[model samples]
Each structure stands twice: as C-alpha cells, then as structure tokens.
Target: MRSNGGPVIRADIYVRISQDLTGEEQGVARQEESCRQLAADLGMEVRHVWTDNDLSATKKNVVRPDFEAMLASKPEAIICWHTDRLIRVTKDLEKVIELGVNVHAVMAGHLDLSTPAGRAVARTVTAWATYEGEQKAERQKLANQQAAQQGRPYTAGIRPFGYGDDHMTLIADEAAAIVEGAQMILAGESLTAVARKWDEAKLQSPRSKVTGAKGWTLRGVKKVLTSPRYAGMSTYYGEVIGEAQWPPILDPEVHYSVLAILNSPERFSGGKRTGRTPGTLLAGIGGCGYDGCTDTVNGRGYRGVPVYGCKDTHTRTPRSIADDRASKATLARLMFPDFLGQILETQNAQEGQSGAQLQSQAKELRERLDGLAMAYAEGAISLSQMTAGSQAIQKKLETIESELVSTAGIPPLDPVKGVAGLIEGWPTLPLPTRRAWVDFCCIVTLNPAKGRHLTSMSVDDHITIEWRDVSD
Candidate 1:
C-alpha cells in the first residue's frame, strides 16, 4: 500500500489493556480491528502487530514485550488502538522520536513525527494519558481502602483455605476443619501431625491463583490455625485492625491461646542443639523435663559422668543411660533390625506429603506477604490492611521457615548404619544435627523417682522415653 509518496509507509500496530475494574476486556480486539481498518484506509502497509494483555502502562516497570520489539525493529510509523495504548510515559515517547517513527491512533488520529509541532502534539497527548492513568490509579487505591475498611473482599487473588470463592463467605467444612486444627495445635499436637490428619481426611489446601499448589502442608495448617481472620478479625500487617464481615471459626480466646503456643520461646529459640561443638551431641536436644520447662534438654558432665539435664534447673540424668534408653526405644518402635530400610521407606512414603508440602506452602505464603507489601507501597491496599495482613502472614512464614531450618539438620535415622553412618553421624555429628535428631527421635521426660532424691533417682524409672512414631 502507498500514498502520494515514492515509497510505501509501513506501520506497526500496538495494543494494550489493563485488567478492567469491572472484570471485562472492554473491546480491546475491536480497537485492534479498527486500527487495522485505519491503516488500510491510509494506504499504509501493516508491518507487525504488538500487544500486551493485562498490563498497565502506568506501572513503571511493566514490560511491554511487543512494544520494545517494535521499537527495535524501527518501523516507519506506529499505529495503536489509542494514544494511551502506545504509551503513557515520556521515556517511551522519546524512544519513538529517537527511532524517527511517526505514530497514529485510531481514536486520536495522525501524528507527524518529522516536525516540532507534531512532536509537541505527541508529548501533549502522552502527558494527558499519563495523567489519566495516574488519576485512575488513585481512584483504585481509594476503592481498596474503602473495601478494607468495610471488611469486604478487595484483592482478586487466591482464596484463603477456609474462605469460599468470593473470599468473604466461609466454606463450612473447611472452616470447621480450620477450627478443629487450631484446637489440635493448642491441644499439643505437632503441626505436622495436624497436617497429616488433614491430608488423611482429604481436606483441600489453600488454592493459589499464582503458585497453583493444592497439597496440604504443615505450614498451611499453621497459617489457618494462627490467622486472626479465622477468628473474624481483620488484620493489616499482623496487627488486628477491625472485625471482619466473615463469621469467626474460632473464639477469640481460643485463637489467642493458639497464638501463645505457636509463639512460645521454646518453639523458636535455637536451643543447645543449635551451636554445639562437634562432640557435644545432646547439648541442644536435651530438654529440662521438669514441671516448668519442656524446652530442649541440655547435656553436661556432672561429677565427671556424662549427664543430661535441664539447663535452666537442677534436674539432671546420666547422659549415657538417657542416650541408650532413647536409642533402644527408637529402635524398638521407629527403626528396628532394618533401621536404614525402615527409615528410608518411611521417608519415601512421605514424599510430597508433609515436609516438602510444608516447605513449599511456607515459601508461597511468604511471597503472598511480599505481594501485600508491594500492593501497599503502590497504594493499591490500605495502610492498615497491608500492615495487619502482612504481619499475620509474616509471623506464620517466620514460624514455618524457622521450623524448616531447624529440621534441616536432622536426617532420617538409621541405627544399623552405625555411629558414623546414622543421621547426625551418631554422637560425633554437629551440635545442631545431633539436637535435631534427638528432638525427632524421642520425647524425653525426666523427674526424680517418686520417693528418691533428685541426685539418687534410678535411671530406669526416673526418665521416660517416648519414641517418635512417624506413620504418615
């Protein structure tokens, strides 16, 4: 196609549309069709078509893939559905000028790039587009704030575990499961156990619009159990700001009690198991099993005899006997003659089940928190909403990640593999490794025999070893 010129004018067509506030595309294809008709009427050859879907020109870092490619191709001219479709930024407009490309819009008409008057017109039109974009953004921000204050669903993202598709209404069964899980956690069940129960019951995990993960996770369970939203409260950045419109799954007192248990110092404090010297095997994993403490047991040499004791108290037990007791109990229950085979089988059976699921969910939740922060910064979410929401998510993420890191040191145990081959290489392993294995292998509860003094208690009955049973 040619005009009154010696050569044909070839123009690339560009189109873009951000997500509609009302959830429609608003005829972007029709705009493209109109642009093509304009190009034909002007006798300009259509060189290429560029498009960016669900992308906002107002966003500073949004990549318009085709737009960049068109500029690189250096077409004679560019045609777009509208002026804003081409650009709402002066930097992009300057790029078009440097490339010496004229631009036209179906709605705004011809842009002559060769002269100063035309350049002025292009800049003016782009500036208006930029301003309009900014105004719309501000309006959206205000709307988000209003939605948050009114306890309405605001973000068009993943539905939380107990919430329905609308995000405002609760799903009855899931909501009941959340409350039951929280009660279990508060009742002294491990997060992993609760998660296993959920998986066993075939409960659905929280669905992500982004990550698309649908596996039950210890991390996900904790998030549901600890979230203030489950208690019918709205949070901004971990701080509860107001009551939500949704019904509460758990009583406020029950929620706070669960929070207390989840946030306990013992749950997070890197115990003696964390920074032990190479030979200090049980230092961090030994908990003070007395009336006041369930923290990790501590190991020490008392009167030249290896002993395990509560670091914070006078409670103590002979370390050699405690280790032997724990080892035998674990072997009897979790890993017998075929220690390596049993543990490996247990681990293989749990692949993509608990540990992996929990880790992935923790990571996904952390990303969700980061997204909330970004939305807040961009003024798309209110300050209170971001703060409360981020705080809740961050707290849960931290707990999950901390648990993940803490568990990283403990390998699946294989008693038959010997001291140097078993998990944490037996007593010669790193402090953290030894601690983690001790925690994983057994629950040691120590107390003075009924009538004996603390120093005179018999090793047999003074301590109780409950070997961990990993069935799921």
Candidate 2:
C-alpha cells in the first residue's frame, strides 16, 4: 500500500531485548517475529531488520550501532516491537522527529511525524518510559541502602578477588594470595611489582562484569589492595558507611599501610610535587647526605640559589655547614646519559621474560610430570610419592601457563620506541603525567658532604641515584 502522493512505503524492523544473559537470540527473535508480523499486517514491505540485544533503552550514552545505522538507511518508517523500545527518552524522540521518519510500534500503533498531534502523543509515551526507568533506579538505590544498613553484603558488581560466588565466603587459595599480596605491599614492594608477580604466577584476575576482560593490571591491583572491603567495611558512594558481613583478607594495620602509600601526596603529585620545594629537580627523592647530619634534607633556595639542606639546619638562625653547591653538583653527577635508557631496558626485560621464558618453564615442568607418571607405572616410585610429586609439578605448571592464553593477542612494545615517544611528547604532556614518569623511573637520595669540608664536596660525594621500575 502506498501513502498519499508516494510509492509503496518501505519500513525497517527494530527489536531490542534489555538483556540476553546467555548471549542468545531467544528474546530478540520473538520480538522480531512479532514486529515482522505487524509489518505484514500493515502492508508495509520490510527493507531491513535491526536489533540491539542485551542493551537497555534507558542507559545513558549507550551506543546502539545497528539502530543508528538503520536510521541512516532512511526507510520510510520504523516498525518496533514497542514504543518504549523505539525511544525511551525525550532526546531520542526528538531525534526521530528531527529525522522526519514516521514510527509504527507493534503494541502502540502508528506515530505520524507529519503532524503536531502525533508528535505530542509520541513524546508523551517516551516521557512515561523515562519516568518508569527513573523510578526503577531510585527503588534499586533504596534497596541497596537498606542492604548496607542491615550489614548484608552488597551482592553486585564483579566479585572481589578473594571472595567466592556467594560474595561472603572466602576461596581458600585466592584468599591466601590476597593476604600474601598485602604483606608484600607492606614490606616496601610497589604495586607495579606486586601486579607483575601476580601476572608471572598466572593468577586469574577478576573478570570484568561489563567488558568480560580477564588479566592482572597495575590499576586493578591498586583497587583490590586499597578497597575498604578487605578491611571488613561496607562503602556506599565511596564512604565507609558500615561494617560488611564478609571476613577481611588483610590485617587492619597492613590494609591501612597500603592505603597510606597509595594515597600519599608524593604519589599523587598533581600539577607539582607537594611536600617538596618547587623548582627543585629531586623534590620527591631529595634527602640529607651529610655523614653525621642524620637529618632529612629538602630542596630549598638559599640567597636566590637552589640547594638541598637539612630541614632543621637550613631553617637555623645562623645556618651551619649545609652545602647548596655540593647538592647541585651531586644531582648533575647522577644524571648519567644511559640512566633512563637503563631503566627502560630493565622494564622491557621484566615484561619480556614473562612471556616465552615462563612458557618454556611450563613445558619443561609438564614433561617432568609425565615422566614421573611413567616411573610410577614402572615401579620406580611409590604411589604416595608419585601423587605428591605430581601435585607439586602440576601446580607449578598451572601457575606458569595460566596467563598464556589471555596474553596471546598482546604485542610487546619496544623500550627504545617508548623512550623516544616520551621525549617527543614531553613538552606537551600534562604535568602529572611527567611527574609520574619521574617517580617511576628513579629514586634520588642526597647526603650531606662529610669528612672533607662540607663546602668542598663534589657531586659524587653527595648524591646517589637508584633506578627503579615502580609507577607509584
């Protein structure tokens, strides 16, 4: 059937299902079938079928790729399973009107864009849909608040690393790992180091609920380490509102220590490094180098000149023998040409050996395990001994190989190229990014000049620089 003054009208079929947990087409297929039937009854030829499965209509900034493409296809009209599925919000309703495309909902009937009354009716239906979505969200928020107040564990989001599916009981092995990770962090190991160790051991990182990605990341380690959940507390809107029902994997003291370091002002040095004097190159790592001074040194300017002096001595009424010239000379000496390149090389070596070397070790362990099985069959070893040996070997092999599948698609970046990129982009990079780079690459310590006169010390006598691979 043709519209007045037009040829046979062609329409696109749109179907949506709020969720398809199994990633199957059961819901959307039924919706599409009904929509196709509606198009047949209306005498409109279906030019294309578009679907947005497992996508919510009310989700903000959600990209419905197929729906957008269908609109661009510019069919004479769209036939949806329902008006709510077509446009749940006013922004989307306005877009349909702006496009001048008519809509026909199988449940709600025709929405003609050519007239004001039809547009008003369409907007009213969409407004109701939006209101319904808001009400449901508010109810959910209230329910979560009630659950928190009652000390019931929040059973949503990706399960924490050490917890089982129930979200309260601990998984013994994973729990042990979490406890050990906390101890390591408390013992001066950096978050980057801890995450690298986990990746090397092939520990299974928590899979993302939304993206389905599975792998250990430094940021992920920091989150797991710093979360109040491990401290037996419940947080709502990022505040500790109450104690949780679940047991904690970390001791209270150790948990707090990790948080202190992770939240330290130096690690979070924004536009400039705080707690250190400005315009000082070694502000984050500057220290007193005097043999007997035994006091903390900091970057400060003396007589319009930059220097490192003991905090107490520099603020002294007469200022004893704290040397500014010796500190600057020390800093210059530590700035070796190969310093950054060496750090980059070390980083490359660490992330590089994690792949093939670990794989080879795993392969060797598997072969040894198979040999032990044969030895048992040949009466070379007792059954109990064979079982013990096999268990240990299998565990070792599993640890080494667990991450190979997940990392197969990742390509290694060259350290030289990384350094080159940093150099080229240094001028334009944000201050925080640049500060992060400095903190991760090296640790500088300055000591007061001793034995010889304090004023006579050279750069080598006062400064010590240690390269490191920590990000924070």
Candidate 2 — worst ten consecutive residues by lDDT sum? 314-323
The digit string of per-residue lDDT tens for model 1 on 1-472 reads 2546568888888888876333344556777798899889888888887877677777877888877888899888888888877778999889888876678888888888778998998889889888887898889878766666677655565577778768878788888888788888878998877888887777766553334566666667777887778888875434345678877789976876677576543453323423424244445655556665666556667678776666564566777677777656644543355544565465545442445776678769967988998999999999999989988887776555544433333342332354346533454544444445556667767653445654666666656877655542
Give the C-alpha lDDT of model 1. Answer: 0.68
Off by over 4 Å in 2: 1-9, 17-30, 40-45, 53-56, 59-63, 209-214, 269-472
Candidate 2 lDDT score at position 377: 98
lDDT of model 1 at residue 357?
Answer: 70
Clashes within 3 Å, all models in order: 20, 6
Give the TM-scores of the predictions, in the order they appear.
0.49, 0.53
**CA lDDT of every candidate:** 0.68, 0.66
**Candidate 2 residue 82 C-alpha distance from true site, Å:** 2.3
Query: Which structure among the candidates has the greatest lDDT?
Result: 1
> What TM-score would you give candidate 2 relative to the actual structure?
0.53
Tally clashes: model 1.
20
